[model samples]
Target: MAQAITAERGQWYKRLDLDENFEVVAIDRDEECIEIQYYSGEIEEIDEASWELLEIAPIAPPDNWSGAFGSDNRVEFEAQADSLETALNMVDNSN
Candidate 1:
């Protein structure tokens, strides 16, 4: 059976079970900091200095990408930009 996120007033934690054998705790936090529990039963407190890592976007290329065109249909590339404005510029400059 899969474990679902059933919110409780004082739960203040999120967990995930993998392979029906091990579990992964995604977020276990209180008022001050967060804690993580691994499958090996090792518990570690996430450092405040590295908290910014959670806010970072995980993407090799951003979603705002403009497709590239070539004389050959099979030869094509994509222009991935950090912002919509930049993606528009990449597509509009083809002319």
Candidate 2:
């Protein structure tokens, strides 16, 4: 199933079509566009159609979970990180 994004300011998203990561800077409901700041520091306005190509960025596991794992489950922690990277790569290659 596809993930749902709230599209709020400061939220990060990965553009599936471009393999680029961007953060939401603003949303113009009247214009139906979202202002995004790319990882490269470029700002652009994307319409609803363009927004459809984006997915919410993967976030790290919660601090409490990490604390529970501590150092004994280093391999499992790495695997989780790798999984997120793979998911992002899949999104990039989808287009």
lDDT of 1 at 37: 39
Best of the candidates, lDDT: 2
Whole-model Cα lDDT of every candidate shown, in order: 0.32, 0.58
Q: Cα deviation in Å at residue 3, candidate 2? A: 5.6
Model 2: runs farther than 4 Å from truth?
A: 1-4, 55-95
What is the lDDT, from 0 to 100, of the residue 23 in candidate 1?
A: 18
Give the per-residue lDDT of model 2 (tens digit) for 44-85: 898976666556564333333223222454455455554434
lDDT, candidate 1, equals 0.32
Query: lDDT (0-100) at residue 8 of candidate 2?
Result: 69
Summarize candidate 1's per-residue lDDT along 1-95 as a digit string, tens digits.
Answer: 33223322111132322221111123344543444433344555554343334322112222212221122321232325445444335545755
Clash count of each predicted structure: 0, 0
**How good is model 1 by TM-score?**
0.23
Runs off by more than 4 Å, candidate 1 = 1-31, 54-95
- Tell me each candidate's TM-score: 0.23, 0.49
